[model samples]
Target: MNYRKATEKDLTAIVKMMADDVLGKKKEKFQSPLPIEYVKAFQNINEDKNQELIVLENEKLEVIGTLQISYIQYISYLGGMRAQIENVFIRADQRGLGIGKKVFKWAINRAKEKNAHLVQLTSNKERPRSIKFYENLGFKATHEGMKLHF
Candidate 1:
């Protein structure tokens, strides 16, 4: 297995992984399948220095996991920055193989590389295993995650 930052060419596979994540849990905010155009948007994230999408691939170069991290500059903390993790997913068959953890570790390092003051993520209550996994990786559940659906 290997890991690398995603390129535009990898969008289709990444979108599939994202879909898997949405389907694997109940109470997730995802409401429908992602269109290929949605992945195209992520592909353009490279234009922003603070945005990144990464993928984990098997020996055959097939993407099996993905994660996106965004960094935002903040004035409240004296110009410090925060890194937010979104859309973390590992292929269903790839679970329990440590691929997810490796992806997260890479994300954390990438955040630090960007000089972020903190790295954060939120998981739904229905995903207890995901919450535990984040906690095991030194992420603290310090805030309530609230969302207003349209």
Candidate 2:
């Protein structure tokens, strides 16, 4: 599998993969031309120095997985840099192939290369299996993650 920065051409496939799951099905609007909002969001992320949108492809060059990493600089932890991983999705057909672990390892190493003090991610509480998978990856539930959706 090849992992690299995503391009505009890969957006459709990326959105499709993200929408395959239950949670994503409710949140993503995956369509043939894709909504302009997604394009705008991609452009914003691409322009940000701290944002990285990545895609994993097979030998055939098919985009099969994707994730976004955001490097946040804050005054906390003595002004440390934190790498936040989000929107991780492996194609449904590609699940159970250890690809998720490999992608995460790559992301973590990338964070280390960027000198991030730590890497973090939050999975929906409804997805117990995903939480367990994260636990296997050495992530701890040290703090409760809360969010207020508008």
Candidate 3:
């Protein structure tokens, strides 16, 4: 698998992968031709210097995995930057092939290159498997993550 920063053209494929999962299937809209908002959101993320939306591709250049990393500078980390990983997804058909590990490793390295002191992410409470996956990657479950959805 190969990884690179995502282009506008990769947005649809990325969204499709996001929607392929159990939780996402329920939340993501999959209209006949999809929606333009996905592209618009990609544009906004792309323009943000703090955000890096990336994709993993096969040798044929078919996008198979994607994630977004946002670098944030905050006083809480001693005025250092932290990387927040989000929207992580790999093709369901492509799971267990070590693709997710590769993608994560790349993200961590990228964060280090950006001078981030730490990398963080939040997984939904419903995904025990994913939580374990993250734990195996050496992430601590020290903090209780909470969110209020509008």
| Cα lDDT of model 3 by residue, 39-117, tens digit | 7898899999999999999998899999999999888857999999999999888999988888888999999999999
lDDT of 3 at 58: 96
lDDT for 17 in candidate 1 is: 63
Query: What is the C-alpha lDDT profile of model 1 across 1-150, one tens digit per residue?
Result: 777878877776766666566554443323345555565576578777788877888998888888889898989788999999988988888889888888888888888988998998888897898889888999898888899999
Candidates in order have lDDT scores of 0.80, 0.95, 0.90
How far in Å is the alpha carbon of 103 misplaced in model 1?
1.2
Identify the leading candidate in terms of lDDT. Answer: 2
Q: Estimate the TM-score for candidate 1.
A: 0.84
Range of the 10 consecutive residues with the lowest summed lDDT in candidate 2: 10-19
Model 2 TM-score relative to the real fold: 0.97
Ranking by TM-score: 2, 3, 1
Residue-level lDDT for 68 in candidate 3: 96
RMSD in angstroms, all models? 3.3, 0.8, 1.1
Candidate number that wins on TM-score, 2 or 3? 2
Question: Candidates ranked by lDDT, best first?
Answer: 2, 3, 1
Regions more than 4 Å wrong, model 1: 22-36
TM-score per candidate, in order? 0.84, 0.97, 0.95
Estimate the lDDT of model 3: 0.90
